[model samples]
Target: MSYTLGVDIGTFETKGVLVDASGAIIAQATRSHKMLVPQPGWAEHCAETDWWGDFVYVTKALLCDSQVNSEEIAAVACSAIGPCMLPVNAAGKPLMNGVLYGVDTRAAAQITELTERIGADLIMARCGNALTSQSVGPKILWLKQQRPEIYALTAKVLSATPYLTWKLTGDYVIDHYTAANFSPLYDVNKLAWTDDLAADILPLDRLPRLAWSTEIAGHVTAQAAQETGLAVGTPVTVGTIDAAAEAVSVGVKDPGEMMMMYGSTIFMIQLTALPVRDARMWYAPWLYPGQHASMAGLATSGTLTHWFRDQFARELGEGAFGVLAREAADSPKGAKGLLCLPYFSGERTPIHDPQAVGAFFGLNLTHSRGDLFRAVLEGIASGTAHVMEVCRALGTEPVRVLAVGGGTKNAVWMQATSDIGAVPQIVAENTIGASYGDAFLAAVAVGRVLPDEISVWNPVARVVQPVAEAVYARQYPLWKRLYSQSRDVAHELGGGA
Candidate 1:
């Protein structure tokens, strides 16, 4: 039986999956890694260790567990957290650790500088996105200015998936979906790189060739085959960011279909017939040509829950997350009047404030751990609601919201998200997420399956209906106010250091 291999490198983990022609997963494996925070407002990952190392380990493990012949693998595909900034030398060795996505706020100054210098209105018109922490253009400028020696030696600037593809195929390329995040450098209208905006950031040659997500990048090299335990001639498709792949995994194909990824961060992607430009949200080319996507993200979501587990629930050990979920379930709908802002890494979408801070307001001595945890979940839900509000305001509202990723397992978080957002979320059966999606994309690339067959591959498992809770309606506004009220103090604290 023909099979496909898929791998995804995420913020805190890497996952791999092997699936047969029938779309049944034969084997799956995962490896965990740390997100390095060198300083406040900075997040990074070691490309050599966390990315390539995980890829090798997971691929080998999946092959061993599945007992699939290496020659039977038709194709390989990958997706990962992006658009990250990782400069590499001539031999494709990482010059430094990869700068992470919207969570990393180290380039805030560069964002502002570029916005003023290039004209914000022009940037929005040309790039279809405003300068924010999510943009990779400013990060490129940051490296050039802050670390010129490294910049001088840089051969190519790549994101997570592109880096993996380069390792696998020895081809420097990026999918358009991931390339759109390199704002000011990519012209959304032209659907190509713009030399005018990129002139100051770096030479256009430093960028990789652009392709669609399902297009084959190149065959795996002999060296890559040796490292990955795959055939040298195995085809590797041009890969995309994890969120886009996750959207594809759950059948978010036609316009008005959306996917809300509840991973380390909360990312929302809604397919659109045409580019929908809004300063509040991002616009990008979808995985396929002639398609558009409206996107939004929160700086933190599941990451906040992880922090709570590590800091307060150490005794729970392996059961920390499950226990925390139960504790949060016990807490009342509105967390007993406590409110939180999940801006731990600064706010994204709508506000676009990199200096924004996280806070638990209305906290009293009477509150318990359950209340705090519940507040955290509700806070993230409120943020999701805000994104939905913006999407609706911009005329890109989704007819169906498909939920995926690790956070969907948390009943409290999922329920709160649906309740506070006032949107019913459909959970798919195979929400193993981006890695699974990558496998499907690989199959499609090699003509093993059609794009429309995703429904047969993984159907809707269940739906999380929005609860008509008056408390949530009342508290969401306060959640919005918490950030506004605390903005000045938060900025002071952020800058004081």
Candidate 2:
């Protein structure tokens, strides 16, 4: 049987999957990587090692584990943590470590500078987004101004997926969904690149050509085939950001259906019938043409749990998150009245505050590690609910929320999100997320499958229903107040640092 290969580079891992024509996974493999924090507000990944290196390792592993012939693979696709900023040389080598997504807030100054120079209204009108940590335009400007040495040698700017596509197919292409994150550089109405907002960011020619997620960009080269164990000249599609692909994996294509990705950060994307033009949330064309998507996310989610485990549950050793989940589950609904702000990487969406600091309010000597951990989960849940509130205010409440990612395995976190957000979540039968979606997109690109067939490919496994709780009802408000009341102090501390 023919097969499609899919790979995705994540914040902390890379996963690859080989699937048959019927959407059954033949084999899957994964590789771990570290996210570099060179400074307090920056996040980076070495493109050669973490991005492309993990990809080659995962793809070869998938092929070897499945014992699948390279010629049997019909097509390949890739997705990754994006809307990132990576300047590359003429040969498509990364000039520096790849700047990560919204979690990295080093461009706060550039964001402010561009927002003021080019009026916020104009940017919102043309780009369909407000300048925030997620916007790649500011980061590009930061590179141009702060690292001119690298910028001068830069031949093109690319995100994670295109970087992979280039390495595989020698094509510089980006899907529009990923391109939209380059604010002031991408014009939403025209679905094309633009330097009208701020020409000084970089020349438009330095960007990758735009294509749809399901469009074939180019064929895999002989060199790439040798490294990846795929047949030479295999079709590769122009890929998208990890979250959008994850959304597609769970059949979240209809308007009002949302995908809440519980990954390193809790990212949410809601398909909308029309552009929900607001600066509080981001808007972008969907993977397909003429479609729209609205996005919101918290600055940190699973990463916070990682930090907590490293600091508080070191004794548990491996599977610390699982052990921490049990401890958190034992804590009361509101974590014994403790409230937390999951702004360790600064806040995003609804409240676009970069200086926002993480805090655990109502902490007392009586609190246990369980209470603190529970507070952390609840804080992330509260942040999620805040985003849902914004979507509702914009009259776009999701018909259903499809939950995906490794964090979904954390029962306490998933239940807390639904309970605090007062929203039911639908978990798909296959939780492989972006890589699975990439395979499906690859099949679609080659006309092997239709988009709507995703339902038949992977049906719903179970649903997480929101349980009403008086504790959450009372504590969520305080959670909001905890951030607002301490905003000044948080900024002061952030500044002093």
Candidate 3:
């Protein structure tokens, strides 16, 4: 039977899947990795190790575990966290550690500089995005200004997915979904790179050729085959950013359908018939040609819960999260007056404040750990609600929200998010996430399946409905006020640091 192989490089892990032509997953594998935080507001990943190494390991493991013949795999596709910035030399070797996505705020100065120089109105008009940490253009300028020596030797700037595709196919190409993150460099109207804007960031020649997500980039080279366990000449599609693939995994195809990814950070993508331009949110060309997407993301979500587990609940061991979830479930809604601002890594979307700080207001000595944990979940949910509010205000509200990612397993968090956002979330049957979506995209690339077949591949498993909660409604305003009232203090503390 014919099969397709897919792999995705994520912030904290890499996963792969082997799926038959009928959309049944034959086998799956995952490898964990650390996200390197060199300094406050700076995030990096070793491209050679965290990206390529994990891809090779996961691919080999999936092939072995599934006992699938290398030749039987019809095509290969991959997705990864982006839009990351990884400058490479002539031979495609990484010049330094790869800079991560919106989570990394080291380029804030460059973002401001670019916004002032090019004007925010013009950027929004041309790129359909403002100068935020999510944009790769500022990061490119940061590299050129901060590390000129590396910039001088840079041959190409690649994101996570493009880099993986290049290593396998020996072609430098990027998909339109990820290319849109190169704001000020990508022209949304023309659907191509803008030489004038790109000139301000980096040499135009250093950019990779752009393609739609489902198009075939090239075939796996013999060298790549030797490194990976796949056969030579296997076709590799030009994959996209992880969120887009995850959205596909859950059948977020029709316009107004949205995918809420509960990963390291909370990422939201809503399919649109045409681009929606708003500085508060981001707009990009969707995976399929002629489609568009409106996206929003929180800088921190599950990341905050992870920190709590590691720091406060280490005694719980492997069952820490489960135990914590139970405790949070028992805690009263709104965490009994405790409100948290989930800006642990600063705020993205709506606020776009890198200096924003996380805090637990109304915390009292009487509060238990359960209350604190529940507060954390509510904090993230409130942040997500804020994003949805902005989307609705801008006339791009999602008609349906499909929930996907590891965080979906946490009942308390899922419920809290739905309740706070006042939107029901549909969980797909196979939320194995972007890797599974990558496999499906590979099938589309080779004409094994049509784009509309995703619902058949992964149907809605269940739905999380919002329970009317007056506490959350009352606390949300306070949550918003907390940040505004404390912004000066947060900035002062940040400046001191």
Instruction: For residue 56, give model 2's deviation from the true position in Å.
Output: 0.5
Local accuracy of candidate 1 as per-residue lDDT tens digits, 1-497 = 49998999999999999999888999999999999999989999999999999999999999999989999999999999999999999999999999999999999999989999999999999999998999999999999999999999999999999999999999999999999999999998888999686588989899999999999999999999999899989999998999998998998989999999999999999998888998999999998888999999999998998998999999999999988889999999999999998889998888999989888889789899999999999999999999999987887779999999999999999999998888999999999999999999999999999888998999999999998999987889888887888899999998887
lDDT of 1 at 128: 96
Tens-place lDDT per residue, model 3, 48-164, is: 999999999999998899888898999999999999999999999999999999999999999999988888899999999998999999999999999999999999999999999
User: What is each predicted model's overall lDDT from 0 to 1?
Assistant: 0.93, 0.93, 0.93
TM-score of model 3 relative to the true fold?
A: 0.99
Per-residue lDDT of 318 in model 2:
94
Alpha carbon lDDT at 268, candidate 3: 97
Which regions of candidate 1 deviate over 4 angstroms? none
Error of 1 at 380 (Å): 0.4
Q: After superposing candidate 2, which stretches have Cα over 4 Å from the reference? A: none
Per-residue CA lDDT of model 2 for 1-497, tens digit only, reads 39999999999999999999999999999999998999998999999999999999999999999999988899999999998999999989889999999999999999999999999999999999999999999999999889999999999999999999999999999999999999989999999999899999999999999999999999999999889888998999998999999999988979989999999999999999999899999999999988999999888888888899989888889978787888889998899999989999998898999999998889889899889999999999999999998888889999999999998898988999999999999999999999999999999999999988999888999999999999998889888888888999999999999
